[model samples]
Target: MNIFADFEDRVRKAVEAILKARETALPDLSRVAVEPPRDASHGDLATNAAMVLAKPLGVKPRELATEIAARLARDPDVATPEVAGPGFINLRLEPGFWTGHLAAILKAGGDYGRGRRTGHKVNVEYVSANPTGPMHVGHCRGAVVGDTIANIMAFAGDTVTREYYINDAGEQVNVLARSAFLRYREALGETIGEIPAGLYPGEYLTPVGEALKAEFSDRLLAMDEAEWLPHVRDRAIDAMMAMIRDDLKLLGIEHEEFFSERTLHADEGGKIAEAIEDLRGKGYIYQGTLPPPKGQAPEDWEDREQTLLRSTEVGDDQDRPLVKSDGRYTYFAADVAYFREKFERGFEEMVYILGADHGGYVKRLEAVAKAVSGGAAQIDVVLCQLVKLFRDGEPVRMSKRSGDFVTLAEVVEEVGRDPVRFMMLFRKSDAPLDFDFQKVTEQSKDNPVFYVQYAHARSAAIFRQAAEVGVRLPDFPTLDASVLAGLSDEGELALIRKLAEFPRLVKAAAEAKEPHRLAFYLYDLASAFHSQYNRGKDFPALRFVNSENGMITQARLALVRAVAVVLETGLGLIGADAPEEMR
Candidate 1:
């Protein structure tokens, strides 16, 4: 199905065989590569080995190229391999080569560019929002990015696990418990005055408190603070987590694991403590006096000796504290334990999708995961920058019941999952994005989600249009490989060229671990199809529906069908829908 890879393999072996047959010492072939020409005039593929080996061989690049091209002429897949521009081998494929790609596309259909699964297990963690509130707009980018990355990794052969880490055991949960306590009092028809400063003021929690009031009522009020705090915190945390899960599901994101921070240390009589102690045993932790912070230090900064990690040795700005002065483990301590648990679960590759504010934490956490896994596990943190919402070229007002925040459910309801996903991936993971609420639903090229979907719909429309004209489109039901040989138009050949580049594209994208490339590829493929579609308007004979000539119609229909297949395949990779009808 991957003809480019197949041809590249053939050419590689032929070159090596030709070299050995010439009785020349074998040069290292590791750096050699096969890639398409940026300009089509440069031929189908271009390689640089001849140019690279020219200086070492003490011969002009053209002379060496002539020698290599002479040897490559005998290969069946390559019709001609010409050396141009200082020994660049521009291989022009046979006439059947471009046309024959339709067979592979029809054979593979929706699975055309799907790569082999790596079989290596990986855990991807994202949207580990505090279990004290619903997911807001900030979660949308990470949710879509993480979900798409999981899909891409899975498609590329890795065993991917989507995980949602719930930080339900922290101080935030206790604060939420106290915040819910006030709402509980209010639900009992008792005025608790204005919601105090430093407490959650969002009205969304009113129902949570109302639910708690119905469940426990006067019982919690009568109980001691110690007894009531845990009950309230646990109930409130579960409610918030339920809201987060529902929001994610609305965005079409599903995680395999909902890991709890509270579960780690509670699993074995304080496992977090055990992990820290183990690190202490390994000389990774130490009590040291740290200097005052630089670059806008905290206002409450105090220089004192406390528990610290040897993070400086692992390439951090400085050693960070693992425990506070009150003998409580700092956030870094829990982080170390979290990754330790990730490794304990037998995952060697861990990826975390976090907001851009965590840029400072990336190096330290990567160093920690590497240290704790004993260099056995590696962590990749993909930081998603902020998403600025727009409407009519102006920032839209967002309300999450708080004055400023917008929930994930709001965006999902506003623009469904496809636009949300495609918009998020339309930019690099590290770049800030402008998401226009109004434009996403538009039917023009301004919206890539709509444009790509329209291309697939247009292809399907061609079939229906052909049928209406009594032009019976071929069903790819025959083995007449000779029928494909009829295609020769420049635009037709251009579409074939894009179709043939798919396998190499997938491999390159996988090797780079960047799913945004897949999005760009879909756009380029759609552009080619649109270009060809417009060209057919000027040249009536180039139209795919040739009722008079069945073979030409079949050949062109086969080509567009191949376009749809590749579109669906690429769209599926980035978690976007390939709709057959735009409306």
Candidate 2:
């Protein structure tokens, strides 16, 4: 029931009939598209059929537009089809069309905007924060963006797998192990003074230390560093990941897969060796020396030959190293193996939600997907920019729990999950976001989450008011267009049009891998609904409830219920809630 898609078919049919009557060969209709007009006042829907087909048909643009508009004007659902500037066709649908669609919305309810399954397996990897400490605010935007993208993708008909790559094999985890060892020593009654430099100072590790003391006691004390390091590191990673999971759960995020980096390095670098060998077989790997980076050479840049991936041949800026001069596999090697593993797992598309700082990895990652799958799979990288926290226009920094940065849990705790999740997505991910603690919690239209949720609350209140007036609304299953014929008001039809945009919005946002669009659409829908509600205040006949007339009241109630359904479905997709009552 996508009106735009439906009309696109109708417009194409009209063109085909016109061509048949003129004895003209048919032109490609794929380029033709039907969409909402940029300005609502122009018309309800706009199309470029005539403009796209005119050159091929050898007809004047305005002439073809006129012919198409005349045919569309014959449709019972179309009130008018006018030829606008540059041969675009603007259509205003009949009142029955809008009111009928409103009934369809109620019948569909939660499933109204759901898409048909595409049978595409998409792997969305997001919020792969290192398992070294509790998740901080720096990871919040990517987390919410990734989770919401997964939600939208699933709703958009892709078989989406939510994944998190655990970065537990790096030197950072080793540092965490050593830091936890210090806490372990303190837990054993050893008067270790201040936390030494180059070690984590956050008290979150205190519990990890206590847990180790309870498990291994003084046994670790006698063991050499080499013998105790692995035991302590594994334990510390588990503790940190547990804390991280709890923090994510507070924001309603959970990954279906948590692929550990250690697995790739297991069996004495088994997976990495296989990945390198595969690349070598494909002639994508070779021993080479990379030129010094542009402008200046990094300190770690070595002039000696090293094992490298021919990434530049596949679109990377330069060939990337697979193994260092020291004979240890580089971090890029692990990434290559991880991608290969995902490819072998049968994913047709891989989506990476990364921080803005990782922009450099985009081309190289795309190269990896190309080489690993031989262009059989696609890769998309979404980068989220930094979020600056403020309170009443003043910057707020530092968290006692995380020592230097604010923890994700702290942000969610301070403002609640709904505000944190909605506001995180209120802006495009590529743009920097300024999150104000006080502003998001305000119970006014200035607060987007509150405003949207308040719309749902108001809808609920409308039903209660209808009930008090002795107007028993018809059940959705029994409601039909006949009951909705009273909804001929311009504002009511406008609200219905906004609701009608949901399916198209969901499809577009999911295809673009931009969940922020959903937030924007929800806000727009809320504004339309609130405007209609306010209009009722000035015009008594425009009110949702008319105690003196039950028929129109039922029709209006159906419209309000449709709004509630859409608001709930959209909020759920973004990992937020739609409350029936704001208070």
lDDT of each: 0.80, 0.92
Model 2 per-residue lDDT tens digits across residues 1-583: 7888899999999999998998888888999999999999999999999899889888889999999999999999999999999899999999999999998999999999999999999999999988878888889999999999999999989999999999999888888999999999999999888877777889889999999999998999999999999999999999998898999999999889999999999998999999999999999999889888888775446799999999988999889988889888888899999999999999999999999999989999999999989999999999999999997788878653337778899899989999999999999999999999999999998999999999999999998888887888789746968989999899999999999999999999998999999999999999999999999999998999988788898899999999999999999999999998887
Query: Which runs in model 2 stand beyond 4 Å of their true positions?
Result: 56-59, 296-300, 399-402
Count of backbone clashes, every candidate in sequence: 2, 0
lDDT of 1 by residue, 1-583 (tens): 6665675566567667766887877676665666786678878877776777767656787887787777778776678888888778888877687777777677777777777766788898988888778888877888888888888777767888999998877778888889999999899889998778777877768988899989997778898878999999988988898888898888778899999888765854277787788888878888776788878775334477778889877767778787766576777788898888888888979988889998988989977875687778878888899899887898966654343677778888988888888888888888999899889988888788888888999899988887898876666735367888899898888888888888777777655556677777788889889888987789888887777787888888888888988888888777777887877
Q: All candidates' TM-scores?
A: 0.92, 0.97
Candidate 1, overall lDDT? 0.80
Give the Å shift of residue 574 in candidate 1: 2.5
